[model samples]
Target chain A: MEKEICISELKRLSHLYDIEITVAKKAGRRWSYIVNAGEEKFLPSQIVDQFEGYALFVEGKDFDNEAVVNAFRKIIKKINAQKGG
Target chain B: MITESSWIKKVIKEEEYKKYMNGEKDFINDDEIMQKIEKNKNPDPSKIRNIMKKSLEIQTLSPDETASLLNVTNPLLWEEIYETAAKIKKKVYDNRVVTFAPLYCSNYCVNNCLYCGFRRDNKEEVRRRLTLEEVKRETGVLAGKIGHKRLIVVYGEHPLSDAKYIANTIQAIYSVKAKTKNGYGSIRRVNINAAPMSIEDLSMLKEIGIGTYQVFQETYHHETYKKVHPSGTLKSNYQWRLYSMHRAFEAGVDDVAIGALFGLYDWKFEVMGLLYHAIELEKRFGVGPHTVSFPRLTPAKNAPYVQKTKYKVSDENFKKLIAVIRLSIPYTGLIVTAREPARVRNEVLPMCTQTDASTRIGVGAYSLWGKEKEQKLNRQQFLIGDDRELDTVVRELSEMGYITSFCTAGYRCGRTGKNIMELLKSGKEGSFCKLNAILTFREWLDDFASEETKRAGEKIIKREMEEVKKSATRAYSPQVVEELENYYKRIKNGERDLYF
Candidate 1:
């Protein structure tokens, strides 16, 4: 089941992580979140399907801090790997 | 009366500088760059070849990889690197050699740099600045008489040539439409080479439709920079100049240029510094410098440091450094100015994308042609080695089987900033540029070329069109190709300025 995340919660997480978060309409009435660390860009929802329970956490339905942190770490690792780390 | 101090106060805004700095620090970590160079002192040949492959793929090499390339001394390996540099330039920029003319707008400077002829303290240099009328007159000659489509307008750092003045001059240059043989001629693109400005001022220029905003670091070595640019001067503030591009990007300026004056520092270290600057920009903004220039130090009338520099780059080493830079930043346009002699420019032309012809470094030199024939060091920034006219250069390039392109379609067509970077890396920009280059070349030959040069250029044009039809069918659809053919015929029949 999918849950809706308010823009305010996403803004709070962006501030905490020191990342620039932007939400834009992907399609008609469908929204997507863009995460940027300087020039490195990523979409949390694209990788959310790869992690169990991560999509729920991103949507503000599940309040598992551990799972959310783990999901963010995986995305960061992928970005760094692309940068030839 | 407007005093010099008041003008200086108006030019350097302190708060603007403070906003961009990272709490008294910014990019250009000198120690880190030095440490990386030291760690990669002796790189293996196999590893270097692998890094060259990365550049072949149009990927920007890391500073570490660039450092290793600079350290290459094996004769055979150097030859291979040079060949690879030519290949990369062709793959990214195609076989077109873009040409421009350097139009010096002003000689009034504020800082007393040790190496420049326009330094404030140089009593021998004749201080001058062109009014809007004079700039238009000069553009009339450059566009109508000389047939140059692009210009890199050079300005000294001072109050009279502020952002507003710069914007007005650009407008004047673009307004001039001159008469040519078959059709009208005009300066289509005007790039700037001037002092750094605040974001607000840069934004003002952006609104006026300026081309690339270029600011050279002069020398990236901190101690050398301080020694050359005295303390308490605007150019002495290294951090402010270092972050000029960052501010320009924030101000909505898409294309920014970076360069370093060779012979001011060790050439190898300077090359590494240029690579680091490009990497940092890509890391922070996802776009690197649109062009990188390496103008060797030349003799000036009263600037003794120019001739007495201990770190002067030899001709052999200068060629090698250009090759290394081409391999390091495959997608960026490398410019070889007229500062080098004709022989040297010919030797290094294959590895560079652009060069200046009929370059006049004196203010109003184009309008005052016969009077300014002799290269007077007191009236110019630095003496140029290649003083050949534009028609001669066009003839030589045609003889070498390379097309001389005057296309400005990419910038006008919205292929700038990150869009152009993506296209360049994907190898699609060259294809688009090829079609436009052919159209513009036909326009130039019809409107400005001499009879002797036109005969030589026609053969090259026919060969280029055959290549386009054979390899670029998908890039140019059948309908587009038909339109291109029509445009080419129209240009030969007295029409001009036709592009895709």
Candidate 2:
């Protein structure tokens, strides 16, 4: 069964990672995910691509929570590494 | 002149003040400060050193700790304090001194400040405000010809230089993309040093993407503030000025700067007052000022108080106080402006994060340069002690092994306000700033550097690049390093305004 990823799910995942996620209309009904960590930003698709083979998907209807959390953890690790932590 | 009551009613938004104030209004505890200073007469050297260690960790010192630093008299201990101050600055901000030029938009002041040349009643002073076109022209010279990436635009406390006018002028300055030698140039950041405004008015500035909004409590001593500002004026309300940052934060201004004009009250008390202000802001807003400025009062044409102040800071005491400030608020940037002479500026550069070069305080002075060789005191607020050109100052800094950075990336990249404060305290900001500094230094060197300065600057850039390669590799991802390298190459190839 294909599950549609709503704004609420994405927002919940953002909260879990302590990141800010904003979904805005791109063209008609298409929504873009804007992920913000402090002053840095990453498109949801970009992070999914960075950690390939994670089963994380930004364009699919049913979003996998485990896959989403794994991708977010990778993003947090990269940012923390940049800050020398 | 307009009636005082009418002007006060128009400018002072009482409702805004009441919203932010406590019932008792216990903002500054003057008696408590005096008692603390009196009690911490002789601090143990070992305890003071421990406090210095804490400052090195980028922690804000308590008022008591700062008072002890102010009272230190032993010459050897002072030397250690100065060394630690430099170390702390390097750890947080790196060996880069950010440079900016001051653009005085208008000298038509409403307040009759005792020590200001632009005071309304000064008959000898000529007042003028820059039109939008004139601001564009001045910015052309600063960004295109002089090569400054940031500006601290100063305005007087008058209706003519209100929030609307400031926003229009800021847009004008940003619109200028003047032609440089090999690339285009523009003022990347515009920080305001203007009169405090109501939360509503400050919101207007926030919408325009203003940089740090700075308001100085000229004298933190309430009695001195009253005497200097006079009664029946908007500035006479000390609490309004004290809580200006609170209003700024409410208006969504990310970064706010605070300062005190030295020589007004006891310098020691003034330093303590600044610490208290920082502490109060942190307590109320969860962040302190992004930067702090302490410009010593210099003589003005018709300002008699400038020459006769009993609390005038001596040269030795001035250096000591600046070092103390660096130690007291290790996370906040300390600005030592061109108000001091070149020699004094040279001595204090290591202990400070930013300074102004090629500074002309007179309104429209840059455009009037060829026509007017000397600075007319009647046209400016005060006499600038260091009027050296930008290239000369840059060369001198390079000779001292410090790179003069023109980077304004952090503000644009969302590394400002609370984000920047956290990075600055954790010592992570310097790593990012170092990369940007190298890229911007390359841009400036290719665009505006003189032959001798370019030679000196190249050496510093090479050294900085090596440091970045070594330190940044361990921290940043490989992608960031690749992006930095690409930008470095582009800037070397005459690209301008490149940042990490």
Candidate 3:
């Protein structure tokens, strides 16, 4: 997917889940993510991705367990598919 | 790509610039700043205490209040102000002092600033801009060898090293993850200290992961500004430089730093100018400067203006300025650089939050660090006072009850811009600072600390953990406390880059 489109999709998904995402670092295979302000989870580049930086952060206690993460992954997949990836 | 002659004209966009300014003028009012300084002289002790109380409440002081604190002449009252300032720093930032290395990437310039050694007119100064490969090489020594996690990457304002070059250099710094003991070291935060840029360039830098876009106004006084920055030069436009932070915010860059080179003007008036600048930022963006730097003018090679300036700030007044700035803008981070000698740094660091250690200001000096005992003044922007190694400085800070923090977790975790501003004012950020400081200090100690320094650092970590356990449920979550203990154990066992 185009970088801007992927970022917009991530923001949309984050807002849908009522989660906040802070962009950190660039896209790399060994990038990580944090969910609901808990432990850092290693992110597979194929599953979890971002445009600017790979470390997407979700703080506070508003989102469900792994739901926001799955939703974001789905968005990335759907957006990449829409662009014929 | 801009050509040489037209780049200066194209750098400042007139229509966008007008939006942030009041008609043709910038926010700083010289007459008002001087009048405030004059009127607030001989302030009563009770009034001074009241102003200090406002600062303790984390409220940004008014110009009158800041001026009153600056006019304080009574040594006993100055002592009280000093105590109050220290208390404010402890309240807002906790007792952790952040450490970073300054990488001066270039010495080329387009302006003839009279106070700077890198002025275009200086024929004796050696001018060079580091290549991307050289920048990575320099970062290797700073991060891999020295265990520094943050860098304030500096660049001179020439067409060759403009914003595009800055963005590229930052990427190079971040890409370097050199192997350290047990784990890797890389610069997570790259703050820029370059010339002012347009909104387009500033936004590009933000997209490329620039942290803390810093531009020092050098001197805020208009007449002095014109005298120093020669006419027909880009930096001669006082409004453009004054409103750099405004342009930064408008471009969506969250963390902008403001500063002044103090010796060029009256120290008291300069403090007032800094306060006004902070107030203007807060009024416009709902967030003030992320950090405020006041580097006293030291002698620079080929810059006769340094010795000729009559407004040189004495060591006593330098301490006073640090205290007053801390009291005036209680939430902002105060940077006391390696410009002052170790004696002066020790005296003033109680009121300051961040400082650089093992700092080398010459172009590509970090890679050539151990080969030379003394810095080449012609290649350096100014002489550095404290050239102690990072381990030695870290040990001293630990002995002083301060944990040398290598944490850039706040930027990564999104506690920036207005979010950081709110946390700092409410004193909630201190909790996060304490937690992260411990984790990152553990990382540094394991990776790069000397045997003697490691012992001192371990003592500090133990004391900090004890404090966390004591405070317990009030400041931290039960889950957080548990996780911190687990993380601490994991980091000690050779893990790296762990944070809450």
Say which candidate scores most in lDDT.
Answer: 3
Per-residue CA lDDT of candidate 3, range B1-500, in tens?
66867877777666666777777777788999899999999999999999999999999999999999998899999999999999999899888999998999998998888999998889999999999999999999999998899999898888889888998899999999998988688888888899989888987887787878899999989999999999999999888888888888887677889999999999998898899999999998888999999999998887878989999999999999999999999999999999989999989988988989888899988888688758889998988899988999999999999999988876665567876787799887888888889999999999999999999999999999888878843356565667789989998898888775
Q: What C-alpha lDDT, on a 0 to 100 scale, does residue B91 get in candidate 1?
A: 88
Candidate 1 lDDT by residue in tens digits, A13-32:
55555343322212111122
Error of 2 at B152 (Å): 0.7
For residues B133-238, write the lDDT of model 1, one tens digit per residue.
Answer: 9999999999988899999998999888888889889889989998877667898888999898988989888767777899999888888888889997889988
Model 3 interface CAPRI class: incorrect
Give the higher-TM-score candidate: 1 or 2: 2
lDDT of 2 by residue, B194-281 (tens): 9989888888887777888999998889888888887877789888888889898887786899999999999999999899889988
What's the distance in Å from true for residue B66, model 2?
1.0
lDDT, candidates in the order shown: 0.78, 0.80, 0.83
After superposing all C-alphas onto the true structure, candidate 3 shows an RMSD in angstroms of: 5.0
**Every model's DockQ:** 0.02, 0.06, 0.12
Native-to-model Cα distance after best TM-score fit, residue B406 in candidate 3, in Å: 0.4
Q: Give lDDT tens digits, candidate 2, residues A1-85.
A: 0112234454566555544332221211112122233223211122233232112223222345565756555554454455574
- Native A-B interface contacts kept, per candidate: 0.00, 0.00, 0.06
